[model samples]
Structure formats: C-alpha cells, structure tokens
Target: MYKVIFRIKGNQGNSFKELRQAGFIPIYFRKNGKDEYYVTLFRGKDLGEVKEAILDLSYYLSKNGKYGDFNFATIYEVGNSNLGKIAGGTLGALIGYYAGGIAGLILGTLGGIFLGELADIEMGEKLVGVLGWPMSISR
Candidate 1:
C-alpha cells in the first residue's frame, strides 16, 4: 500500500469523488484556514496510478475552468507511524509542565496524547493546522 499527500487550490469536490471511484481511499480532506485551498491524503496501492488520476483530474478541471487552477503543491510518500502522537504528547507535557508544574504536566500529557492519537487517525490534521502540510496518512 502507498500513501499520497497533495494539496489543490480549490474544493475540487467532484474531482475527489473521481479519485474515490478510482480506488484511492481518502484519509484526510481539510480546508486550509479560511481559504478555498485544501490539503488531502489518499491511500492506494500504486503510486503511479494515483499520480495519473490526480493529473488527469487536474487537467480536466483546469480545462473546464471548474475550479480555477489545479495545481499540486507537492506529491510525496510518507510512512505510517505513531511518532506524531508521541511527539504531541511530549510537547504537550513540556508545555503543560511549564505552565502548571506537576498538575499541569499530568493534564498536558493526557491532552497531548489525545491530540496525538487524533493526529494519527486523521493523518496530519493537527500538523496541517500548524505547518500547512499533511505529514502522514493512516489506515
């Protein structure tokens, strides 16, 4: 299995449907801030097929002027890992500890763990809010 992460300039709702039809399972679809842009994650078996589908969709959408322009920021593969949750917990713990000492440390650790687990399940949803990029995709 392969994970493909990319961002498009508009909603591209229909295009996403097409991808789903092509067997690319959407793992994440988030609007960037208040903008029309979106960052998405899809999981599929063949990377080439995934790329071709995206290119075809973009070309068709662009030719029709349906979504303005179909430009991909980048398309890259990322490993499925639990590191996000661990990192989130660590950061949360540090922040919580500094803010509230022992009690804060406990609360922060729990909050961080929750957020981290959510991030993994949502495949960079939290990271995207911070870094403006989808770092990973999960099953």
Candidate 2:
C-alpha cells in the first residue's frame, strides 16, 4: 500500500467528495484551520498512477478557483509486522496465568490480543518505508 499526504485549500467536505467521485478514497483527513486541510490517501495502485490521479484532480479542482494549492509532501510504502501481536499474546498469557488462574488467563489473553492489534496498526503505519517524494503538481 502507498500513503500519500498532501495539503489543500478550500472546503474539505467538497474536496473529499470530489476525490471520492474521482475514485480516490482518503484514509485520513484533517482541518489545518481556516480553509487549509491535510489529506492522506492510501492506494494499492502503482506510484505513477497515484500521482497522475492526484494531479488530474488538482487540475480539475483548480479550474474552479475554489480548490488550489495542492502541495504533496511524501509518498511511503506502508509496512506490516506481526511481531507485536505475537509478543503481546505470549506476554499476556504468561502474566495472566501467574495472576488469576484460568479466568485471568482468558481475560488477559483477550486484552493482550486487542492491544497487540492496536500496536501493530499504529506501529506499522509509522514504520512505513519512504518510496520517494512525489513531484510537485502545479495547477
């Protein structure tokens, strides 16, 4: 998966709608105060395709003069790891077995699994390897 982060100027709602209409789904969106917004989109497509899609959208939106200043920062290849889940489960089982017998063991295992999944997701997203910086698209 590739993660693309960019900043845009205008109503985020409409921009997001336009993006969806263009077949681009945003994974994350944030209001950077005022008319500025930060949008993060994830795609499994080729890097060139992703860039082209965004460029085309920016161009289309820019013509309206309501959406412009689409500045892209970096594109990263998202990484995945199962180590966290495995380690968490094992540790939880051990601790639970020692603390409260069978009941504790079961509860602890479930809790640990949940936490592990969260850790996996959070850490995995952050551990992304940089694919490359996308060329700035000028509208």
Candidate 3:
C-alpha cells in the first residue's frame, strides 16, 4: 500500500512512462492541469525508496524543464486494489441475486467488474474518479 501521491501540471505524457519504470504499476494517470493522484505502485513498505522515486521524477522533470514544483511529496498506505475490487464484485453479485435472480447475478457481477476496474488505482488515478476518495497528498 505504498501509495505514491503527486500531481502533474498541464501535459507531460512521458512522466507516465517514467513512473511505470520506477516500479509503479500504472493505475490511472493522464495529462491534466493539476490534480492529486494515487498510483498502483506503493506495494512495498519503504518510504525512502518511494521518496527516491519522487525525487527521481522531480529531477527528470527539472531536466526537461517541465513543471518545476514537485511539492507535497509523501507516502501513504492505501487500500489494496484487488481487495477493493473483489469486495465490490462480491457485493454486486449479492445485490444482483436479490434483484434479477441468476441473470442479475451475471449482470451485476459484470457491472461490478467494470465498476471495480474503474475503481482500480492500478490503472492510474482512477480511484479518485470512481470513489471520490480525496487525493491523499501530504507533505
């Protein structure tokens, strides 16, 4: 749950690639003005390494003369994406069983999967969008 929190300003598409290379599984990251985001990377318990990645990213950005302010670099232990998805799916299946019998179960599970996937922070910053979870950025 070593969740990396940061924001990108305007368009810097290559940052996503660098982030992936930093051992972070991209959950949801896209070009935007500025917004806090949680990536699927923070699996380990080492904040030093996480901070290094952030520093590396900052250095990289500085080299390219991109957005210069990499502030509020912090680490967080966020909820597991797989666990959250499974819970969502299971809850969906249960609700489906009550709503439309077997068909509902299938539909609900599928819907749940989609919702779960959307809920996936592994794909990049998607958690904030799907669940409205406030960006856990800290200094």
Candidate 4:
C-alpha cells in the first residue's frame, strides 16, 4: 500500500471529511512531535486511476482561477478556520469519522481502491490535547 501524508494546518475535522470524501481513508496518528494524518489508496485495482483522481483535485485547486494556488497551506488554513473549533466533543468526533467515511465513498466514486475487501478506513483513535495530554476516547 502506498501512503501519502500531507501536513494539515487547518481544520483537523473538515479536512478529514474532504479527504475522506475523496476516497482516501483517513488514519490519524502522531510521529516525533507532530500530529499526522494519513490517506492511503491501497484497494484500488488501478494505481494510475487513484493517482489521477488525486492529481485532478490538485490540478483543479491549482488552476481554478479563484482557488488557484490551492496547496498544503490553503488546505491547512481553510481546515483550521472551519474545523478548528471542533477539537473536543463526542459528537464532533463522530462527525469527523463520518467525514472520513464519506471521503472514502467519494474516493470510490473517483475510481480509487477503497472497495469491497479493502473498505477499512477510519480516523485515529486518540484524544490527546494540543499539549499531548492523554485523554479518554470511547468507541
């Protein structure tokens, strides 16, 4: 399975949704000292299709006059501004996971590999504060 992790500087929530909707499953975790989000395309029968779909999105954001130059910074800023306030809450967490699931569906539509036997996608299982304090998160 190929993995691509992009630094999200925005809403850890909505961007989760957007990415999920794109079919790439969201797996949240931490490494070193940074919080990380991973989106993987492993179930695809066609790697080229997956790559193309993601590239298409990137291209749309890059050349779409109004949203042109949309890159990591833009994604981060938007996600932060919109989803930042939803850091902690039972319902918020559910919403985040749902977003991830929907993204998986979207990815399916875009011809990714998140299908049938490979539909296992979800958010990370942790609720540490920005300070990395351990918190309880019940499934």
lDDT (Cα, tens digit) per residue for candidate 4, span 1-139: 3334443332223344445555665554343332334434323544464554455434333232211112321111001121222332333445545666765444433333222112322231122112111122111
Count: clashes, candidate 4: 13
Pairwise lDDT winner, candidates 2 and 3: 2
Cα-based lDDT at residue 67, candidate 4 = 19
Taken over the whole model, the C-alpha lDDT of each candidate is 0.55, 0.60, 0.57, 0.34
TM-score of each: 0.39, 0.51, 0.53, 0.31
Ten contiguous residues with the weakest lDDT in model 4: 73-82
Which candidate leads the pack in TM-score? 3
lDDT of 1 at 9: 49
Better of 1 and 4 by lDDT: 1
Which regions in candidate 2 have their CA more than 4 angstroms from the true location?
A: 11-13, 80-122, 125-139
Worst 10 residues of 1 by lDDT: 130-139
Model 3 scores a TM of: 0.53
Q: Return the TM-score for candidate 1, rounded to 2 decimals.
A: 0.39
lDDT of 4 at 70: 21
Candidate 3, residue 84: the lDDT equals 50
In terms of lDDT, model 4 sits at 0.34
Candidate 1 runs further than 4 Å off: 1-35, 59-64, 67-70, 86-114, 117-139
